[model samples]
Target: MSKSLLQQLREMTVVVADTGDIEAIEKAKPQDATTNPSLITTAAQMPQYQSIVDGVLLDAHKQLGDSATDKDVANLAFKHLAIEFGKKILAVIPGRVSTEVDARLSYDTEGTIKMAHDIIGLYEGAGISRKRILIKIASTWEGIRAAEQLEKEGIHCNLTLLFGLHQAIACAEAGVTLISPFVGRILDWYKKDTGKDYKGADDPGVQSVTKIYNYFKKFGYKTVVMGASFRNTGEITELAGCDLLTISPQLLGELDSTQGDLPRKLDPEKAKSLEIEKLTIDKATFDKMHEADRMAHDKLKEGIEGFSKALESLEQLLAKRLAELESRESKLVSAD
Candidate 1:
């Protein structure tokens, strides 16, 4: 008998679970996993994850000694939580985990590079090799520049919030490890603006990723393209042979439960057969293209704002926890 549709598709593309929830990740059984500030913040709020965060803080305190400042402790605590979640995810999936840099440093190239190294340093301290972690960065030009340098140093990067070909092409030229072009976010912009629904191969968001995928394959660019931020199964099904696709657990469940022969929609051979022209753009051309594409520009800003807000929330939570700990410590000293 032939393999199931899911099994067949798995042969071509790497499926990554896009969640910080360990239980959901384990259930999906994706080859790789990705976590953003928002997802991590959501996971940290769950009662089940409270002990995990507490344990991380306990370990951070022990490692840094009681003299460690709250900021120091908070950074270490957040890293520990991220790594703990990553460790759990790595057990279920054989591929890398994408842990993001703080969104606040998206435009600060030097700071972004330093933070990326710090994140990797924390992971390496836990016995996880640099190979198993993909430092995620926003797809801004400065972020791309930071990634280019990092890639040369053998640190793999996953460029997130990518929308325009300018970003994709620049990333490809820089030889970054991978680029995640957001699909649903692009769709959301179009849907809200025009009230027109796209179907099957007609999705503008899917088309953006598809164009990038074909461009890379056509030019023999080694950088991988991972379609992300999917809105529906149709977008997922449309880009079946993408290098990778990070999906939410809810969508993964939807794919698993549906009964149909899922077709292979994106074949490199087919891409080559189509005689698509090659594209190489300098800064001027890139800027022009970006200016012409309203959806890409709007979505890119929205994604950055969304991530920035999530990071702020995480910071606020960490601050509150630190203050509580300080209050407890004050009381203990007073009692003594």
Candidate 2:
């Protein structure tokens, strides 16, 4: 019997589950679990998580009482809901959980920092240590600045939606705990741009991550790189020795079922030997390079907007659920 690809990959890399599905995470049993607004919204819709969703909304409503409007309850519920899911995920995974701050605050440095403090505080109030939580933020300049401050305060961060080397360098310089450079989305852009089939190392997404990984290792940056948003097992396989890879459960299943000789693709020692230039990568350099890289620029903006919409949808769901709960309580009182 051959060792599954997932088993082989795990030997060289730390596997993290990028999902909100508890059962999936349980089976995959990745070192860490990550949740974004999109994943959380999808999870909230499931019948099994009804109690979890209701519990969060109802508790927020109860705390606020009649003074809080539906929007207020929904807003409060939205904030606590992410933490509640994080707590549940923390229960099952021993490593950590990446719960994102509100995407609307992505470009707001002050707001981002405050939310990071609030998020970490919530986790701590629940008795979950700050060490076990990674407050995920977008990889915007403002977001990176916020992360830098948070890191000094012992709040770890995962700079997400990262695309170009500019973002990676900025994150490394910021002393961020981790970065989630999107792989699949980059592939999507290149495929549409060139209409050419790319596989293995030729994949633009894989290439981007390889570049960033090598840059980080070569320059001796403390920040760890985690390749994220993979489109297939091939992309995942191509970056085998990454510090971490947050894979979707569907892809994790593919890796688990397939048998193969998975080789280490990225190595720190190998990276150190490779000659790569280090950029100053301040705000001006970051903006210039970001503007030059069409793929990164487009993807970063699209990602933020998409997550923002997911958040909006979640608040709407919470509002509706809150109304349902309120109506039920009203009916019970009338009957009494």
lDDT of each: 0.86, 0.94
Which regions of candidate 1 fall more than 4 Å away from where they truly are? 1-5, 59-72, 324-336
Residues 1-336, candidate 1, lDDT per residue (tens digit)? 555555656878999999999899888888899999899989988888877776777677779987888677777777567778777777788889999988888889999999899888888887889999999999888898899999999999999999998899999998999999999998888889999999879998999899999888887899999999988888998998899999999988887777667777787877766677767767777778878989888888888899999877776776567667669889999999
Over 4 Å off, model 2: none
Per-residue lDDT of 93-168 in model 2, one digit per residue for the tens?
9899999999999899999999999998888888989999999999999999999999999999999999999999
**Against the hidden reference, what TM-scores do the models get?**
0.91, 0.99
Cα RMSD of predicted structure 1: 2.4
